[model samples]
Target: MQETNDADTTPTHVETAADLDARIDAADRLLVEFYTDGCGACAAMEPILGVVARETGVPVVTVNPRDDPALIDEYRIESVPTLLLFEDGDPVRRLADGFVGAERVIDFLA
Candidate 1:
């Protein structure tokens, strides 16, 4: 008596810089999905990112580095699909330039 694969599987939209401060400070693992407006890979990875974010109950905010030059400089992000993992506001790992999956996300932290 269980249900999985709900039809309403929209990736929760995360759109802000300040929103991250609290979560980044509290979370052991933070996945920041950095992307631009017209990135094909970024578009493709949306749902998968959402699923993982929700499953983990972590703050997965999308940072448009191009829009915010400071972010680009802050994280040194040079790719469309970059996932920056932070531990207590300190960056522990970074996965970049592609549509990496959920298992891969877990693997990065491990």
Candidate 2:
């Protein structure tokens, strides 16, 4: 039987700009979520992202720009719950529609 509640399924949090760079550099392909506190849509994505990470075998990470404001400007974020797909340490695609399901998130990565 396979365990379904492993901590690895959960998305890691990026605390700083450097941390974000390091994570993006470490993974060949990564899904980075830009979210802010008190965001209902952002809160809804947590479980979906975990499922996305586990099902797609892609590492997912979340960063609240409030912790490091530079991330907001660096990523050119215009709203909360923006999903960015990074490949080879560069952002290749962006999905900022907000409150997407697991299938949509996985499709975005593809």
The candidate that wins on TM-score is 2
Q: Which tens-of-lDDT digit does each residue in 1-110 have in candidate 2?
A: 22434544679998899999999999888899999999999999999999998887788999999899999999999998999999999999999998999999988988
lDDT of 1 by residue, 42-68 (tens): 988888777765565555657677665
TM-score of each: 0.75, 0.91
Q: State the TM-score for model 1.
A: 0.75
Lowest summed-lDDT stretch of 10 residues in model 1? 1-10
lDDT of all the models against the reference?
0.69, 0.90
Regions more than 4 Å wrong, model 1:
1-16
Q: What TM-score number comes out for model 2?
A: 0.91
